[model samples]
Target: MANIGIVIPAAGQGKRMGAGYNKQFLMLMEKPILAHTVRLFEESDFVSEIVIVGAEGDISVIKELVYYQEFHKVAAVCIGGVLRQDSVRAGVRALSPTIQRIVVHDGARPLLTLQAFHKFLEESREYSAAIMGVPIKDTVKRVDIAGKVLDTLPRDYLRAVQTPQIFDREILEEAHQQAASAGYYGTDDASLLEWMGHPVQMVEGMQENIKVTTPEDLLLAERILTQRR
Candidate 1:
């Protein structure tokens, strides 16, 4: 098995959730959503190390949470940058030199099943890069700023991408380096790889793997997590 390291970017200020603080700190099932996410990776035998890139103000809280929870896998709770990509880059830098495979997962996505993640890793072993996604069920449309439909996108050609995106450490590092030079900002890490002409494998993911942003999403996540238990 390859040595794995995880980068969880939790620095986003989720204004949509209307939470006074960072939404990841919000309680979910009697625990913070970030704790749930970290614990999931901490419990995994495949993962050797984990780094959480948090906002400047949240670093102290994150450290306290890790210390209290005894999250041994967490190597550091470093300060993040302005953009999500910058946070991910900072998190990646915090990993140990021994880390071979890197997994980039959202800190808000606490419902990622270990079984699902293990299966994804297994299927992604042969490829240098792979991402989890689910086929879109709803009809997607390209709309103009004026609220008129520009074009209807074919559902078959689209997949809603989710986190726990895995990549070879060296290649991922190189992609980030090149992307920074080109001033290319990708929506996801896989997009950075694609921009560099890397073939990314798409593995099937569960619909429940959602990045919690709004209050409605939090409720749904609780319901799903309750069902899992």
Candidate 2:
């Protein structure tokens, strides 16, 4: 079995969440949102180690949370960079060289399931990289800066990508290196790999696995948590 490590990026300021504090540190049910995400990986039998990349000032808080919660699988909690891609790179670099595969998940996505995680890993075994995504239900339109609709795009070919993206360690590392060298930044890990001419497969993701970025999302997350419990 390949040594699988999980990289969770929790350094985002969560400007959309409208919360004074970082969204990851916000309360979700009885615990912090990030704690729930960490616990999920810690409880999973397939996850060998977890590396969390957080904001500079959040290391002590995250460490205390991990210790208090007794999250055993957490191998390292390192400071993250300004950008999301940079944070992911930091987490990936923190992983042990022996780790063959890595899964990058969002700390705000607290509802990620074990089944979805397993599926991503299974897909990564066949494809060098795989990410969770859901087909866009609404019709998309290409609008200009002035709000003029340039084109109405068919939703059939569109999929909203989600996190918990799994990749072969070497492939991901190379992609990050290429992006850094080219002074390029991607919105997600898959984007970086895709730009490098790597085939990135998409696995259907669950609707419950949402990134909590707004007040409405927080409410939905609470409901999902309650239903799961």
Candidate 3:
């Protein structure tokens, strides 16, 4: 079995959330949002260690939460960098040499399931890089600033990507290195791998695995959690 390590980036300012504080630290069903995300990996038997990357001044708060919650698999809670890619790089650097596979997930996505995680790992084993994504159900259109539809995209080729993107540790590290050297900033982990001429496969992701980015999203997540109970 591959030694899987999980890296969660929780350093984003989340300005779109409109919250004064970081969205990951916001309350979700009486627990911090990021805590729920971390607990999922902590309970997974396949996960060896979890590295949580937070903002510079936010480390103390995350440490408090980890101690209070007694999150067992959290091996390190390190400070993150300015960009999301940089933060992920910081977490990857913190991983032990024994970790053969790495899964990078969003700390804001508290609803990620074990099944999706397992699927990502299984796909990554066959393909060097794999990410969780759902095929777009609605017709996608490319719109201009003037609200003019430039082109109607076939939904078949469109996929809404999600987190828990798993990859072979070496492949990901090399891709990150290449991205850094080229000064290329990718929107997601798979983009970095793709730019390095690596094939990125996609695993089916659940709709419930949503990243809570706005106040409305938090309400929906709360409703989903309530319905699950």
RMSD to truth, every model: 1.0, 1.1, 1.2
Location of the lowest summed lDDT over 10 successive residues in candidate 3: 115-124
- Measured against the true structure, the TM-scores of the candidates, in listed sequence, are 0.97, 0.97, 0.96
Local accuracy by lDDT, each model = 0.94, 0.90, 0.91
**Steric clash pairs (candidate 3):** none
Candidate 2 per-residue C-alpha lDDT over 1-229 given as tens digits, one digit per residue, 9 for 90 to 100 = 3468999999998999888778999999989999989988998888899999999988999999999999988999999998999999999999988888899999999998877777767766787788999999888999999999999998888899998888989999999999999999999999999899899998888878899999999999999989888
Candidate number achieving the greatest lDDT relative to the actual structure: 1
Model 1 agreement with the true structure over 13-131: per-residue lDDT tens digits = 89999998999999999999999999989989999999999999999999999999999999999999889889999999999999989999999999998999999999999999999
Model 1 clash pairs are none
Instruction: Choose 1 or 3, whichever is better by TM-score.
Output: 1
**Model 2 spans > 4 angstroms off:** none
Separate clash counts for every candidate: 0, 0, 0
* lDDT for model 3: 0.91
Cα deviation at 38, candidate 2, in Å, is 0.9
